[model samples]
Target: MSRLLLLSPLLLFLGLAYLLPLSGVMLQSVTTPEPGLQNYSAALGDPLVWSVIWRTLRVCLCVTVLAVVLAYPLTLLWLKGNTATRVLVELAIMIPFWLSVLSRAFGWLSLLSNRGLINSWLQSLGIIAEPLTMVRNEFGVVIGMMHFLIPFAVFPLASAMRSVDDRVILAARGMGASRMRIFWQIFVPMTKSGIVGAALLVFVFSLGFYIVPTLLGGGRSVMIAELIYLRIFQIPNWGLAAALSALLMVSIGAFLVALIKRAGVSTT
Candidate 1:
């Protein structure tokens, strides 16, 4: 009873700060510019909305796979290395988190855009006759997003890898298992929980990314988040914007529930 009383202020703060705004958005979704499910229906029926969703999903999926592949070796090095090496690896992974997303996106922009540093260097070497369009496309968006999301994947992966029993690995080796076999059959299976958690975290984070896709993609690779922004600010379609917001909330909620369930099962 005492603890409950002590937590009351926090609970009240959450209700006022989060729940109230969410409730308003949800209410506006159905009630704005005439009621019913028309806005939802319009969003679903519009081919352009579907295209944006598909692109978003595809880009996020690619980023998750790339991050996992790239981070796995680095994770192994971090776990197996000396103190100095581990510190160096950790610094490399974490330094990006301290920088703003906009800055990182712009940094990539300067390097990847046509006639940017990369293209100019290539041209000077006579490697290409024309500037390649790297920015304002899916390729640029994927690169920027993957760079930002790798740390999220690495930390979860490290946590999961740490929980793995080294004794099990030794036992597998004692049984004359090859290194490849041990890694594929034993170590990989044990770290499934971590991989799933990391992938989910990266994928969900990529889903709502606005700045990277906006700056790197140059309005060409318009993602769901950017589309939502355009609906509200550009087109002034409040009903559709509210409906899209509701959809994002529901989608993110579902993923969170799944992540929680996965964590629970792993613990048990």
Candidate 2:
């Protein structure tokens, strides 16, 4: 009873800070423009909304796959490295996180633009007669999102890999198992939880990403989160915006739950 009383303040704070704001958003989304289910109906009925939602899902899936593929070798290297090497690699992974997302998007914009660094170098080398259209497209969005998400994927996977017993790998190797076999049959299975968790985290983050898609992708790439922002702030369509926001939240929640279930099954 005493401990419960002591925890009340913390619980109250969480309720106020998190749940309250979420409830307010839900209320606003449902109640605005004369209330009822009109906003939700509009969100569902609009083909453009569905298209943006599908595009968001596709982008998130692509980002998750790219991040996992890139993070794996880096995680392996980090796990196998010495203390100093580990620190250096970890710092390199974290550098992007320290930078602002907007700044990183801008950096990508400069690199991927027609007259940007890559094009300038390519032109200097006579690689192409004209610059490539990398920026203001889905390509730039994926590249920038992967850049932001790789570190997130790496940390969780590396931490999980570190927890895996080195002796297990050695034992498998000693039992006539090749390195590739041991990695696939043993290491990959053990690290499945972390991989799923990281993928889920990256997907959720990418789903709602605005800066990378907005700055790097221009008008060509329209993500759901960006659409929601425009609806609420630019067009002042709070009802529709709120509905979209709610959908985003629901999508993330579903992903998280599925991930947790998979993790549980893998662990079992």
Highest lDDT model number: 1
Find the 10 residues in a row with the least total lDDT in model 1. Answer: 259-268
What overall lDDT goes with each candidate model? 0.90, 0.88
Per-prediction tally of clashes: 0, 0
In model 2, which regions exceed 4 Å deviation?
A: 82-87, 265-268
Model 1: pairs clashing at backbone N, Cα or C within 3 Å = none
Question: How well is each residue in 212-248 modelled by candidate 1, as lDDT tens digits?
Answer: 9989887789999999999999989988999998988
lDDT tens string, model 2, 1-268?
9998999999999999999998989998889987798999999999999899888888889999999989998888777889998888878787888999989999998988999999999999999989999989888899999999999999879878988998998899889999889989999999987888788778888888988898888787899988998998899999889888998888788867776886683433
Q: What is the C-alpha RMSD of each candidate to the true structure, in Å?
A: 2.3, 2.0
Give the number of colliding residue pairs in candidate 1.
Answer: 0
